[model samples]
Target: MLILAALLASAAPVPVASHERLSVIANGEKVGSVDAVRDHDHVAIHYDVKNNGRGPTMDETIELGADGLPQRWTLDGKATFGGDVHERLVRDGGTARWTDAMGARTAPARGTALYIGQSASPWALGLYARALLKAPGATLPALPGGRLRLDPLGPATIGGVDYRAFAISGIDLSPDLILLDKDDALFAVLDTGGATVREGHEGEVPALAALATRLTAQRYAALQQRFAHRIDAPVRIRNVRVFDPVTGTRGDPVSVVFADGRITGIQPPDAVASPGEASIDGAGGTLMPGLHDMHAHVSLESALLYLAAGVTSVRDMGNDNAFLPDLVRRIAAGEVAGPRITANGFLEGRSPYSARLGIVADSEAAALDAVRWYAARGYGQVKIYNSMNPAWVPAITREAHRLGMTVTGHIPAFTNADAMIAAGYDEVTHVNQLMLGWVLDPKEDTRTPLRLTAMKRTATLDLATPRVQRTIDRMAAAHIAHDPTAVTLELLMGGRDGAANPAVADYIGHLPIGLQRRRRQAIAPIAGPADAAAYDGAMAKVKQVLKLLHDRGIRLLPGTDDQTGLSVHRELQIYAEAGIPVPEVLRLATLAPEQYMGHDQQLGSIARGKLADFILLPGDPTRDLRELHRIAMVVKDGTLYFPSDIYPAFGVTPFAAAPKLTLPKAMPKAAGAGPAHDAMDEF
Candidate 1:
């Protein structure tokens, strides 16, 4: 991959002031700022950022060569959970190099290489795109060696501001969007939830974000136009190791065949295919059921991301009642790229501290009405939120169960998991939520950030004590499942600054450099020895609580409340750390969720007549859970997508090559590019 942008002398790239700044807002709160300055043949950028309510607090800087590419980049502060960042990239013409957690590395540079670094700032993409994206595939081949392909989607408008846009590919499961103004300056950095570039125009986010969503859909549609293979004949995966999530066993090399979204045949290795059958050479790789992320907040963007990561299915824990149904419908109709969704209704109560998400109810009858509302809308589960009234929970759960929707969510403020279970909660949301009762008082309002900040005190609790064990036993007896989003807990309360966190260390280098720097930012406050000690204690508490829950026969559901594509793999690793066996963990990620959602017979295991929702991996995930990251191909609802073909759009180099497939004669060609897709009609 490109080490960093090469610094070269050139004329002014854009009209500039000596210094310019933009306010950084997160969740509607102004938390920090980004400062940019330009001089003759030189530019510098600085970001003082903090993601609101449990995110990185970081300080970052980037210096551009006269050519407007990175010359030097540096970041320092608390990121991810908390880690000191000391990264620098220096390019002296022919060779560019840098030093990071992976150690020093050097690479040849073109001197005129027109590319951005892993990413110095969200604004940098638009800055570079302005100079590079004059036409399709214009700047890609010249980019060091990352093989990045920037396909300019053409001019588009956000809040009616006419801006040029492009889809950035090469690093993740999905491509991110970059926008430039009419003057060719970055209008904004548009990602899934919001943007950081258009700092002063928060009001435009909803409109820009909506536009971003539509743009991504168009790109994925084009991808489908290019890659999706639907032959009239049967489809077969040959010479592969079939993994049974139910048995945790890798079957002998066999050929699995399916068509019309159902597996129709399983034959011995080397079996001759029926006439006109299409085949994919699996080359002895493992074919396992697609993974399930049970704790997801569904979005149009995350849907594509999850599917690309081999998560063929996700259980959306909570989301916008207005947005999800349409997104889900489009995905089901094969109009969008995403996993099968089992949605959960978000139930919240109006309060001063209540999170502004999902449905809000003020009375018992309103809560019941909310339950009916979700049920009528086809939600299979109802997720109660932190600010919900404990007194109203029993009635809410009763109504939800009566409406055939399972109850799961945060134990309402001031109530324990045991109390929620007694109130008929089928499942508890996060590991911290399950254990918080052991460390908090009745008056502690969990609706605010305190719900997360207080987890450190759990370290002081003895797992064997009645206070903690009673809940475990009650949950086991009641068959109440716990969604232990372990990755999130560690991120919130674990990891020391400057130390390599095992949860992210192995994969950090593979992520986009900007995300790597972002991951290094801190979340929890660690002001001193006492504070640090509490953080340390929280990690132990997580292990103990999870172990006790597992050892005592309490059900533990695997999911990543964070982005699950790669994080889900880390979730399994964390489960293994808690002494859960690898095979069990794999089952927990696959068959377990399918069974819970009542789709086991139609999905999950790679059995006959099952839905063709599975992935081809380079290695066996049953043994090393991290192997899940090396996705080769994903078959969702019988439509095949190659990671090799998908990852680059998001800036990720493919970890493995796609299995060989014989293309059908009917395969479609790339549609026209250029002016046909220009966002500005008048232009």
Candidate 2:
């Protein structure tokens, strides 16, 4: 997530003599700009970015103390999805106070107690790093919560200009990698898929982004080495009940055996263990097919989180074309830990609001070319974005369908879901995209955050209305599916400034402090009690629509556009809360998605002939959907992973303990014999 910079501009601006300009690049495209002005102890930063039709726009002002850390800071602006932002931090004497999404809080400051602003500009990272350099051990107690540590990544040369690189950890699951100039001022912030760099040095962003990704990959690779158990011998999980998706029931205790990445057999719990085999005591738990996130944007961190949440398969709705293919390769080559990905080609029409993920076409012919490009690259589907030309959908869908690729996406600007379905779209991407037609005027653009903000109008909507039923009827008649992303709606519209978000409340405490604070904040602007009630009513309406769709036999996909992996579980929870049976909800999360993507043969269930892709849970999920959260172990392609061993690396408290693993007795070696090709030796 990009930093949500400052809010409103200062009423009385201070003149500055020095200025630095930075460019915000996403997927190799320029999406935004940042201007920093310095005048003595005061620094003003104006940040604005517009990509995928929406980004944060804010102004930040900081008054530095003698130690070069902020003494007074103010930020006000709009968040990425149109949430209101007005954050402030003030340090006076030995006391520090600030107000953010978590409301106001006061903490005693003692000898450089650093304050990490919730909506600070990227420049704040450089400021924090500079101060931490002076702190003992390059670490300091941070405000709100947690500790900040600065680790040098050594030097980098971009465009023949030398700079020092550092990683600031503790605020998030992954550290923030930053490049600082010789003066210790901000120069660039590098990320896996995007970057913010000096204006003239934008040409080096791709290289810098790649380097950031490599650095992060190295860390995850080390984790994979320590946590991924890829043994060479048969592995048996004993005393576990297998959940049958088709039957919607858990069978009697059994011992499941797998070796060399395939399931070899399923036997009784009392079956005798063979030589050269490893055994795991499942402790009478349930062994079910690993869950699937129907909608996702995969990254290395999210990939690991998916496994921790017991999600083995994900259908990536959109991602960086170059980055995604490489990630897939590394995952397959065993360089990192991740879920099986089903990539969808991102197709957008070139406009000011175009999402810079994949092919951006300006003409109908170019759109068709984009489809062929995705087909050649083996993308399973084409995800049309908001800025695409409505007129081009028919041809794009036709081309994608001809290539045996599914067509799914948002309703393009100025068009409704009815039109896209008529144009041969196989599925609609977001629930708002489908429902906005019933509430918005023809001229109101769904290309912007209005797609989310407009849901407030749903409070007054009548599902029985002719226009609403017409769209639902057409989708049923056309056999078109809908990915409601209901959890996203709940997160956007239902969050209050200081209250815990219902979508993620169950496990929010297990996350880092920074993430916990963020989850409690409202994403959609709720001005007053009336507006809050409207949003609440709107969320209720969203659930009602989900129930209607399910009752009408319209295939509903459980997807969270948010890619934390945990959200996918919340997505299924919302489905269950919408009156869908718990068993059916589990089916939607596992078998239905696999069947939708034609991946069921190998991935959707736990069977003797299927790939060894399942998760071990301490409880029966059929009895309670919440049991899905406590994942003891995950076997992906026969490689074992225990969540309890890997979650600490990301600052997450483990939810379940690892099951006991018993290895076969090692054969005594001959006095002069060479090493044997045995399972223990392989490990």
lDDT of each: 0.72, 0.85
Over 448-521, each residue of candidate 1 has an lDDT whose tens digit, in order, gives: 56777788777687887888778877888888888989888776665444454556766776665445543554
The whole-model C-alpha lDDT of candidate 1 against the native structure comes to 0.72
lDDT of 1 at 608: 86
- lDDT tens per residue, model 2, 173-240: 77889999887778899988889998898899988998888888887888887778776668999999
TM-score of 1: 0.80
